[model samples]
Target chain A: MNRLDDDDDRPLSPEEMLRLIEEQQATTVRRLGGDPLLTHTPWGITWLAGFGALYLNYAYDLLSRSTALAVLFALMVLSMATTFFAQRTVSSQVRGEAADRGMMYGLSWMFGFACVVAICVRLSPLLPSEETGLLWSVTSMAIVSALYAAGGALWRVRTMFFLGAWLAALNVAGAIAGPTVHALLISVGAGGVFTAVGVVQWMRRRGGA
Target chain B: MTGPRELDPVIHAQARLRVVATLNTLGEANQITFPGLRELLGMTAGNLSVHLGKLEEAGYVEIVKTHRGRTPTTYVALTRQGRRAFEDYTATIRELLDLG
Candidate 1:
């Protein structure tokens, strides 16, 4: 550890002082958060494998509906757990208004999804099995897309904003294509997008972009 | 036009300057733990404490000692006055450099 000296009288050119200020600010911003890849990759994998299982189960009858749903549920749980732990690890080290904002943002996701689940539960019993599945998947995707877009806008992350827009469009397209095709579209389209975004973020970090 | 603008002495010191700059990165209502700030700045605890004292005296920083569970912790935040002073200091530096 460097001892702080009474460098108050130390002469620095204006350029040097400006550079020092910039450097300190940059370092603090970088150090305050966990890597984005930690959150993105787990979610990507969960959606890919979970939705892929659903597609196979629905299209080819390769798996039972119960088994497919179980796989999706388990993967979703795991992804949520990973995200929670990653956030907790980072938030524990920092405190303040930004942390509170982050906490509220995370809670919004839970609150939003709980509402989606409740709505789906009430509506599912009235529809046919296929429509019920479509309703649940579509509504969930819509909520997720909306949250992502909002979060992206809040944080000024362009890629996240665009990804959310893309997901919203993809969800609509899948719904239009009908039920079985909806699962297939989400399995390939949404899953692929998530994985691709995760990979791009990871590469950017590795390349120090 | 006139003689060069003077930077705030309270924020112009190298160590305190770095501290203020880092704290400024946080949101207006945010704070950093003493250990967190020290580790970020790579300063000795004694050195940081001394500098923080000086900044606190100048009303540039607010240091709050509180407990989290059974553990005691100190949090350091930049007061609004400190932020304004930093902004003024930067403006003066930029003017001196003729960077507008």
Candidate 2:
């Protein structure tokens, strides 16, 4: 967290420095909508890492090394973009009283998850087939989606909450019924949920001051 | 006109309140940036800088300055001593409030 070298030119005593850190921290919480959850980076980080690992596993087994590499490249690009976007939305104070960009951020992880899924589904037909690994792969994707959902809720992101709720439904249904139900979930359910959320966020942004 | 209320007196300072409470919640590095502090407090730069300077003078904060794109930025983090002081402050308040 401390990216700077210790300033030994230190005008303040060790005692004074501690005081400043405390004061700044209190202000930070207020900035984050006073949400208790945002203070803990590890909470965000755990899901972020978990999702990354799960996606890695899904992409790692690709039959064509080129495809895997391509997917990896996509991940890097999406991650950098997400970082840029999240920073822009979060750091900027809402222009008006009702403007909470937290809701808008749902599309962020949705975009992230979609990238991975699109790439994986694209590679599906290209793989060797004695072992389908279909059920486990679906389950894994479902779990990753659950994390995304839960994480979004924790972050006060309505978009993520919906994604999480839907993914949870998909996880349970898929576990019981297998890939027979995937097309419905991937197409109708996910599309419906993302569309509804995206519209709501846009409306809210327009409505805000 | 009897005794003080149960709320922690030490959290009286707003910026310190953010730092202590914020750090209290985390295990990994307890550090944040000027932008984060800005958002958390919703304060203008001058106002925060004033309070932060006071806290720095008090040894309650550790400021680390760095440059990006030729712009200098500051990172503020809580010290171990600061953490204990805040914990004690909170504990005393909790005891008074029977929150524990």
Candidate 3:
């Protein structure tokens, strides 16, 4: 602990301020590290399941197939909470000023952008009815995921960038990948990729230690 | 004729100052949690609980509790009175600093 950690001492450096901010962004994820998404990898993709499950509901509801939208919504919230948990866990484990204040939150912005797209698609009837709700939901997830990856990349978390890029690629590949495959890619491929990344990162972290 | 000034910890001390600044990062414009305040301040649980208790006593902060599943999360916020006190404190501090 330097003078910066000294409570009774003088002010902190600008670098110190940035470090504090970084740790806070990842607080919850760290506090709740058991989340599936927070796996040992930087790009664990299991988080995409929330969107994949949501997509199934959209497909079902299309035949005017009404099920438990509320339940699904609840699950979505749970998934987000878990994701935040994983993020916070990772942040907490991060040492030094650089790790504490990594640029992870920007990923949520991508989600915001995706949400906007989902809303637009929902209102416009551009996508198939069955795909409508899921479309909106997944689009939003994609946006957020992409941004988070971007943030991870910015923070030099190569795994984060790898995961984010994979999602952006998924969106591009969606047309060819189609819905069922797209969903699987996100849920399985993407998720597996992320988990792998987390594992590898963790290994490296351990090896370094 | 005006009265005597106020006392607000959210506006003072290195610790409370860090707490509010960190909360601002959440951007919800809503409340913060006890664990969150503790994390933001990077203080031990008991130490933070003590500072928060003092702030609450001074009418500078308020705490609300809720549960997510079995875990109880405590939400904290600056009261209107607390915010006013903090604002007043900031102004006085600025004035004092300016005098220096």
Candidate 4:
């Protein structure tokens, strides 16, 4: 028997006792809804750096391929080192769902990259080399923007949703503006938005702390 | 009123109720660390440990201990059984309230 009913001699009516329990449950549920784990801190600078590297690789076509590859390798090393340290410092319990979501997010990006590569290769046979890069850029941007937008909808995060919308708009604007302008728009416009979001989140976290 | 009769006594205890309630809020995809759970429930380490032990013994929750660099961390997740029990408990509680 529940402890609530253990008191046979209790003067309170059943309705009154039930009301109290309901009220308590409501309070508990409300408190639970406020759990901090729901909001994730966006590592804006990391993403900005990543996008900047890509833009640089495309914008400076005269740069040696080896140099571009070396820059990418350096960026990869930096990202890995930062992640290794972050895991040790961050103190959250990752559940299976969060882990699964992360895995899916990574897979989506990889798949998007692969699709862009395959499309570029196919288009190269039909189009001039000069047009191929621009086509690839626009398609890749659209894919990433759509993926982010889809993720935002699934996660119900307003910031993520807005970022996705912004990226899509940038991609459209880039298409009309030409290759150099498109690269700059992605590297600065979209990248700036992500960085700003991260900065604001960092400031809020510091303030709260 | 006979509250929904399926309430698991192991889960109905006041402190454990809060713990389970909090975990349930995360929607099965996330676990809670020992410190996170303790702070959320406002319980001391010893008290929380005892309640967690009971839940673990009942096979309702799975506890994992891992090392993050030099520090040892403990994570707790509700097992499928535990989730079902929690659901049943809430349904019963709702039934009891509605009986009025």
- Superposed by TM-score, candidate 4 places the C-alpha of residue B47 at a distance from the truth, in angstroms, of 5.9
Scored on chain A only, each candidate's TM-score is 0.85, 0.40, 0.54, 0.60
lDDT of 1 by residue, A40-131 (tens): 67777777888788888878999998888898899889988888888886676578887897899999998989999999999999999878
For residues A109-144, could you state the per-residue lDDT of candidate 2 as single tens digits?
A: 566567667766766677654123344346445655
For model 1, name the residue pairs that clash.
none
- Give per-residue lDDT, candidate 4, residue A77: 62
What DockQ number belongs to candidate 1? 0.59
lDDT by residue (A1-209, candidate 3, tens digit) is 22333462355333443444355445532332233335433233334544456456444533223433454456556655665666665444332233434433535464577668657655757667546644654666567566757666654556557667777787567636556555556656666666676666556444532
Ranking by TM-score: 1, 4, 2, 3
Q: Give the Å shift of residue B40 in candidate 2.
A: 1.3
B1-100 per-residue lDDT for model 1 (tens digits): 2327767877777888999999888869988788889888988888889889989999999999999898998989999999998998888888888853
Q: Model 3 misses residue A140 by how many Å?
A: 2.1
Q: List where candidate 4 sits over 4 angstroms from the true fold.
A: A1-95, A124-130, B1-18, B29-48, B54-75, B79-100
Candidate 2: regions farther than 4 A off: A1-84, A87-143, A146-180, A187-209, B1-10, B23-28
| Winner by lDDT between candidate 4 and candidate 2 | 4
Cα displacement (Å) at residue A125, model 1: 2.6
**Higher-scoring candidate on lDDT, 1 or 4:** 1
True-structure Cα RMSD, model 3: 12.5
RMSD of each: 3.4, 13.4, 12.5, 8.3
